[model samples]
Target: MDKPTRLIEFESMLFTRHTIPFNARKWGAERELDRSAYVLLSRIQIDGPLSISQLSQAFGLDVSTLNRQTAAMLRAGVVERIPDPEGGVARKFSITTEGERRLDADRARSIRSLERVMADWTPDEVAQFAGFLNRFNRDIERLEGRPWPRP
Candidate 1:
């Protein structure tokens, strides 16, 4: 296939079809965080406390949308508002202990699911795919001028 065509198909499968994560939360686990919470919690866990403005800039979302998401997270008891560490005018959101636990559990579950799906693949194959994905993600982040924190 041509390059553009191949890229289009890859995007179709990865996003439109949900091939990679395959909606892991629905596969198993009785208590599951919704997609927005999972992503927000992961971001908060990585970056420490973040104001709504920071979150908006990081995700390219508007403040109103973030307000709703953060409000929902507050109600879910996954995040708490705190005085900004820098004593800025805007308060920031910090992940609660429950949020940390839930995020860890959810990531573990997703990894287990990936393991099951890749059970037949060789270690080298897995490593190569992972490298490709990381590179792809990094390139996109670079183009978008929004580098994601990695550890």
Candidate 2:
């Protein structure tokens, strides 16, 4: 298959062009959180006390962007900076109690949304869809020359 044709079809299945902008609005209306900030917080809450550099790399963002987001989180008391136990020039951040509360609320809302969307789906169908989605992601990464990393 031609690369452009394949890419177009894959993206169409994965994303709705019209609904792309709508997701941010929906997420914000549901939680009073900006989509970018919410995504940043979710990443941190799931995988922190990580350094700013780590986050920047993981999210494919620049240092400045990560710093700005981290600063906002700190000001909101959603994340706290701590001296890196690993001893670095960089400081580490951990999710605070408020952060956990926010994460839990967001998770609950997401679960409800997913449940409602999938109400008619059978458990077996859901499992198969999830499995295929995972494989699709892996295949795309491979095609892009990103070999899957070890867990």
Name the top lDDT candidate: 1
Number of backbone clashes in candidate 2: 0
Clashes of each: 0, 0
Error of 1 at 70 (Å): 0.6
* 42-117 per-residue lDDT for model 2 (tens digits): 7776666879888876667798988888888888888899998788877898888888887677667666666666
Q: What lDDT does the true structure give each of the candidates?
A: 0.86, 0.72
Q: List the pairs of residues colliding in candidate 1.
A: none
Identify the runs in model 1 with alpha carbons over 4 angstroms from their true place: 1-4, 7-16, 19-22
TM-score of each: 0.89, 0.73
Q: Tens digit of lDDT per residue, candidate 1, span 56-100?
A: 999999999999999999998999999999989999999999988
Worst 10 residues of 1 by lDDT: 16-25
Candidate 2 segments whose C-alpha is farther than 4 A from its true place: 1-29, 140-151
Global CA lDDT computed for model 1: 0.86
